[model samples]
Structure formats: C-alpha cells, structure tokens
Target: MSERKHIKVTYSTLASPDPLLHEYFDESVVEAKAGFGKTFPMYINGEERTASQTFEKRSPVDLDLVMGYFQKGTAEDVNDAVATAKAAFLAWSGRPWQERVAIMRKAADLISERLFHMGAVMSLEIGKNRLEALGDVEETADLIRYNCDAIEQNDNFSRPLLSESDKHHNRSVLKPYGVWAVISPFNFPGALAGGPAGAALVAGNCVVLKPATDTPYTAWLLTECFRDAGVPAGVFNFVTGGGRSVGQTLVDHPDVAGVTFTGSYDVGMHILRTFAQGRYPRPVIAEMGGKNPTIISKKADIDKAAMGVMRSAFGLQGQKCSACSRVYVHNDVKDEFMTKLVDLTSQINVGDPTVKDNWMGPVANMGAYEDYKEFVADLHANGDVVFGGKILEELGNGYFVAPTIVDNLPLDHRLWKQEMFLPIVTVTGYEDMDKAMKMANDVEYGLTAGFFSEDDDEVQWWLDNIEAGVLYVNRSSGATTGAWPGYQSFGGWKGSGSTGKAAGSFYYVQQYMKEQSQTIVG
Candidate 1:
C-alpha cells in the first residue's frame, strides 16, 4: 500500500583476548553499500598474505558488501603450502601419539576459552544469529576435544593369537596419513573444517586448509588457535582463494596424501574424478549436498508437525545440506496443516539476525538469492503460491526472500524433486501412507528424511521405506548433537553422497592408513 524504503544496518564485531577467536565486525543500519571492501588473509608456509589477485565477497542480506578483496591463491602458492605441510608431516607423524594428543587438547582448550569471540565472528561473517553461532563454536570445541580423547584412548595395540606356540607374538597400531588437504564450504564453516582438521591433527597428520572464499576469516582465527597451542608453524596451513585453481592445485598435487571436502555434489564429483585421473590416487572424504524430505501423517499432531517443519525449512535460511525442504502431508489434514504452516511462515521475522525477534536472515550470496527466486518462479508457474512469494525490497543490498509455502503440485514437479537451497518450501498431498512413503523415496537424494505420526506402525513404515542416511520420527530432521558428530559415516550413498558410513567416525583412522600385522617367534 505504501512505498518501501532502505534500512541502514550496523554490524558489531566481537573482540577478546583469546588467540583462538576474534571480535565480531560492527554493523549498523545505514544505506547498504554498493560493494563491500573487506580483505581476507591467506596463510601459507607459516606466513599471512593478501595476494595481489583478489576476489569479491558480498553478503546476500542486502547486497551490502560484506567483504571484498579475498586473496586468490596461485599455483605457486598452493605448491608452497602443500610442500610445507608435507615436510612438517614427515616429522610430526613420527612424534609419539601422547605428544600429539597433548597438542590437540591444548588447541581444544584454547578454542573453548575463545568461544564467544569465534561465535561472534561466525555470526558477523555468516549472518547467523548469536545463539546459533554460539552453538557452532561450542560444537567446534567439542569436536576438537573429542578428537583429542579419541587419540588418547586409541593406543591399545592389536594382538595376534598363537594357537600352538607359546613363543609367538603379533601387534598393530594406528598411524597418520602424511599430509591432508582440507577444503571446506561456507555453511557451518567452523564445524566442517574443524572436524576433519582436528581429527587429522590428533592422528598425527599435518593439514593444509583452503577455507571458502566467502568466509575465510573464521578459519584464519582458528588457525591462530593452533599456533597458540604450540602446533608447529608449518603443521597447519590456511590458503584463501578461488576454488578453481586453488582446489585443483591441492587435489592434483602428488605429494598431498589425502583430501577432505564439504560442498555441492557436482564439485565433489569433479574433485574425485580429478584425483582418479592423476597417477597418484588417494583417499578423499567428501560431504556433498542433500535434498532432505519430510512427511506429516493424518494421525500426527499437526501443530507440532508445523513447528518442526518451520524450524527445519527455515533454519540457517535453509543453507544446511540437511535442511528439509519437501513436505508430504496426508490429504485428510493437508488443508488444516497447511493453514497452520502458512500462519507460522507469515510470523517468521525476516530481518537482521542480530535482532532478538528475527528467525530468518538473508541468503549467503546473490547467486543463492537468484537461485531461490528462479526456483520459486518455476514453482509458481506450475502450482499455487499458498503464502509468501516475493522479496522484501526494503532491505537494501540484502537479498531477503519471504518464507514461501506452495501447494497443489504434482508428484514429479521440479520443485518437488530438486534441491532449492533457500527458505522456500513446497507441499504435496498423499491419500495413503504407502504412496506417501513411495513419493518421499523417489528423489535421487538420500541424505535425510523425517516423519510425524502417533502410530508406531506408521513411523516404522516411514523408517523402513525412507531411503536416507539419517531418519527422524515425530521430531524435526535438522536436530543433531555431538554423539552424531554432524559427519556421517565417511561417505553417503545414492545421489546424496559417496563413500560409506565408514568415514568421518573415529574409525576413519583405518581409512587414512593401512593396518599392518607383525608376528615374532623366539
């Protein structure tokens, strides 16, 4: 009814004495800038540099520039970083496991002391609310401590039995992979990078990390923690740059012993293919994207179901790989449940994450916002827009899309099957539980699935029929804890991921190195 206006925003940064963390950037409400001028430092061979070559980094919140001038690594930089890590690993891996565990424990303690600062940076750089950002920091600290505990208790040696001879003995133990190249993405930057890097370091391997160009500051701060913990200068290297050259350079290097990646499926496959083509093949642990699905049954509590769906669909702006975007509700309650869902969606506060009442923030980048717009347009063309359908133009430079809910879609619609990484959600109705289960399992993705029901039989059916690595019943699918490690068994199956449930666990020790059995007779 009235013309909308731009709102100026102020960003506040976190600063503390802990080396493991840094202060959040201060922000305020103001006319959004046409571009952000922030610069990121690249850590290579124990040195920090902002390379002459740089890339632009913009925040999706209001098209306001978050950071620009990210250091782009060249082939030479990659080689230098990798060489440093390789050289350090040669000596580091030979150190006693107890010493390695001590270093990891110190790093974990340092991270704990600096949690608030690190959390602030995560919120500032990634646009997550303070609470969610704190969760990320705490979880990261727990992961580091978990790895240390894992290393400490892993010293038990395997013994071979001698059936007939009393003078025979055999044993085995865990060892580190030489040098690991860790490439992480923007979403959950700390958790993804920290999990693999911490585990590798605890197992006695040095790492070379290439943080996402959009969010490299947090990794830089984390690296400082490693340094404060007495990790040797060359033991952990952080390189900030474009993925094309830097990613390939790291994966293609012959000396790097292994690779750990978290991002999209297409990129993951490309890395895997390149590694295979190279004569030197190595282990790669990759966590790709997911198109998580949800089902609401007639026997379920529609209110609880709606709440869970809202949290799962809009949490982290649906940027997480495990965010549930697809919903299949039984026809009996579809109308009733849709009403509650739409009301819940309308109530979500779409504003700055720092605001106490805000529930959703801007998407990560313009590209992501454009993708959300395109997907919603296509969904509208084929179906009905039940609630939200347009962007909030008042938020300048910020890419803010209303929480969208669409229904009246066919089983095979584009929005129903594809992964739309945004706050938009689509609903499909099924009359029968069997049919609902079938439709839920039809997508190529097998990352995560959720079901809401009071009947034991219905829950069991969904669990048995769903083709996902993670399944949830009567609760939101996005919930996870330390016991879960946020890392699935090193790999996933189907279009969702690769490898098996065999990696990403403490058992990953077996994936990186070979077990040797030694027998001695006197």
Candidate 2:
C-alpha cells in the first residue's frame, strides 16, 4: 500500500476507506490464520517464560477456530513479574525523560507499521469487524503517541517554582511510581491494553500487563512491538491466566506501586478496595463499565437521531463501556425514530467479522453469549421487542445474536438502570425535557451520553445538564461511541471511573507520577 493512500483511520472517521486498506487486511488475515493454535509464552524480565500448564483460546467468531494456546500463569508468575519490574524501575525511571519519550514513540510507530497483522489478530480473537478492529489498533498507536506528546509538551512535568532568594533554588518535579499493573478487558484489547501500558511506561513506570484470558494473543502481539522497540529488560512484561490466580496476585503484590484497570464495576471496585487495604493507599486508575444513554428531542433531525442511536447501541454488539443502552425520545417523534432505528438495525449483516462484508461478529465469550440471551428474555417478558430478539443459529456455531430494541419498558424496571453490556437497548417516550434529563442522570454511571436537538437552547440545556464525561450532540457517526485519541478525552464519572481525569487528554500521563518539591540551599 502506498503511504499516500493510507487513510488515518479513527473511530468516527471510517467512512469510504480506500480499497487498498482492505486488500492489505485481507492478506494479513490469511497470513495470520496460517499460524493458528501455536503455544505462546508470558514475557518476564524481557524474556519469554512458560508455565507448566496452558489453556486453549478459541475465536468467538467460530469455536472451531483455535486462535492460540496461552500459558495459564500462576501466583508465582505474578510474583516473578512484579519483582522483575521493581528491580528494573530505578534504572528505567532514572533515564532522561527525552530518552523514554523516544522509545515510546518508536514503539507507537512499530504498532502502526504492524497494524494490519495486529488488526487481523484482534478481529479473529475477539470478533470485532474489520473497521472496528483496525480502528482499535490505530487508536492504540495514537494513544501512545499522544501521551508521549503530552510529556514532551509539559517538559517532563518539571517546572520552576518561586524561590525565596537567589541562593535558594526551588522546583517542582513529577516522578514515577515503582511498578504499575495494567489489567485490560477483552473488548478493544489492543487500545485498552497498549494505551495504559504505554502511558505508564512513558511516565517512567515499569508495566506488568495482564490481559483478559480471551484475548492474550492480541496482547502478545502488542508486547512484541514494545520489546522490538528496544525497551530495556524487565521494563515491560506480559502475563496471562485466570483472574482468581494470576490477576488477584498481581493486584495484591506489595511491590506494585499502582494499577490501571478497565473492566466491570465490581472488579474495578474490588481492585480499588484491595489496593487501599495495603499498609498505605496506592493509586488505582480504574474505568468501569457504563450504561450510557441518548436523548432525542422533538425538534431533532429524525435521520441523524436514528442513525446515531443505532450505531452506538449495537456497535461491537454493545460490548463497549460507552455503548448507548438507553434512549429517551420525545413522545412526538418517538414512533418515527423507532421506525428508522428498527429499519437500520434490520439491515446489519451479522456473520464472521473477519469477512469484509460483515458489519458485526459475535460476543467475546460464552459467558457474554449467555448473558445476552438472559437479557433478551427479560426484555421480551417486560417490554415490547420491536426490532430483533432471536439467536442467529444459522450463522455457524459462533455466538451471534440480532441487534435488539425494546420499547414501552416501564421506567421503574431494573433493566433500565442496569448495565446489560450486550446488543440490546431499552427505549422510552418522555413528554417533558426536564423529566427526560432526570431519567438520563438517574443511573449511577456517568461515562458517556448523546443528545439530538436542532434547537440551540435545547442543545445548550443538554450540554449543561448531561452528567457524562463524554458528550455528543447531532453526531451521525455514533451517539456515545467513537472517542478518538486527542480528539475526545475518554473517561467517566460517578461509578464509571475512579479518577476524574480522562485518557487521551492533557492531564492523563501525569496520573502515573507523583509530584515532589525540590529545594537546594546555598
């Protein structure tokens, strides 16, 4: 592919991609499939290590396709990884900030160079379609580059402070914590795993990345980019195993100075509380899931409202933390919006995500597949299943389900408040804008929200009243989804995120460090 023809793909800007992108991705997918079912090892102290036992990872797109075999790491492995990181922290952190930034930038460029293969592995491993998978990889590279840029622009977060006299020099310097554990979820494995790991590393902290068991292969590919970029030994490591053994051990390790986790609310809370119960509190940057919502006003464009809501609600099968799960359309245009949404939902082609034509693939695993079924059953029992509610058994043995929309659900229903995290959405009609805003902010999560209003007053009202960290108005690409690095700061509020700061923003990289006041008296 020519460099000139390369489209800089992002979450929101994936329309009309050049045909060469598909040609290269298709070639990479075939090459990736040729080397399936290989056993992969964990990385510790810049070397590959293996456990006595291993686990099989199969694609959600097809259970018959064994993606790879990954080591089932143990508590001992976590201890080893943490100790290695701690041993390497001083040297890594002591290096000049410019050197660290250069290494991270090279790593980001390496990720971009290997984008096709990485995107292919992600799609087959986690069932994301071509564009979404490629976008995730591209975002990973951009996220790393963004953090590096933030550090450089801030001058390594070292600033001169007011001095009492000329003889006395005073300055404020931000320094790295010791060891950081990055726990990433399966959805968007490349971006979530590599993004945090990159930030922590660029901030001078050694990283111990523990990816979700379902997508270790994708994480492994990411680790190679860092290693190939000449990151020092023991500065970056990767471990894979069950959460009970490997994950808990990493979090509980006393040598660990901090953590960055992205997953469910219960697990994030557990990590936060666990990190606090130590001798002293440590930093835990956690982003839990969100039950995001989108509101449509009577004055809104019906086409934009329907398209945005459908894309956000069903993208990635609603597995994203920012997926729009709830909708409150004005009673005047509720029927019209639903008609368009259902028609758009019906046209979505669900099959093998690796195929070029398929728009969506499958849920990450059997647990999510079962959860989707239970959620659909409950929606059918309590609400009107207007769009779809069937399991796509004809689409091979993969865990494929139709995009579902339910209307007329009671406002008091628990599902309306709960985070389903599936390709299912609940819609309700509201007569008053104030009541709709109240319903939107009633949920505990404040991660992301969308509003459709052509009126300037209503737009300003929505912006002022919406409680989410990320908000969108009149977007046709996606309602609550499509946050790109440097374009939108992706984080949450309330039960959604532990920290008030968002990723890909100016303030994110500094979270990995602590400020120290420096003084020299003559």
lDDT of the candidates, in the order given: 0.72, 0.93
Task: Look at candidate 2 and tell me the lDDT of residue 190.
Answer: 95
lDDT measured at residue 408 in model 2 versus the true structure, 0 to 100 = 87
Superposed Cα deviation of residue 109, candidate 1 (Å)? 2.4
**Full-model lDDT, candidate 2:** 0.93
Per-residue lDDT tens digits for candidate 1, residues 1-522, read 122222111111111123222122122212113223656577776778667777766555545545456687888888988888888887888887788778878887777666655665666567776556655666666667766665566662244545346777766755677888999888777777887788788777789999887777678768888888988878888887788888889999988888888898888889888888766667887778777778898999888788778777887788877777888899999998898888878898887765556767777777887897888788788889887777877765677778888888776677777778787778888888788778878877787777888999888877778888766777633421112343443334576666665333656545555466677777
lDDT of 2 by residue, 403-427 (tens): 9999988889999989988899999
Best by TM-score: 2
TM-score of 2: 0.99
TM-score of each: 0.88, 0.99
**Each model's RMSD to truth, in Å?**
7.0, 1.2
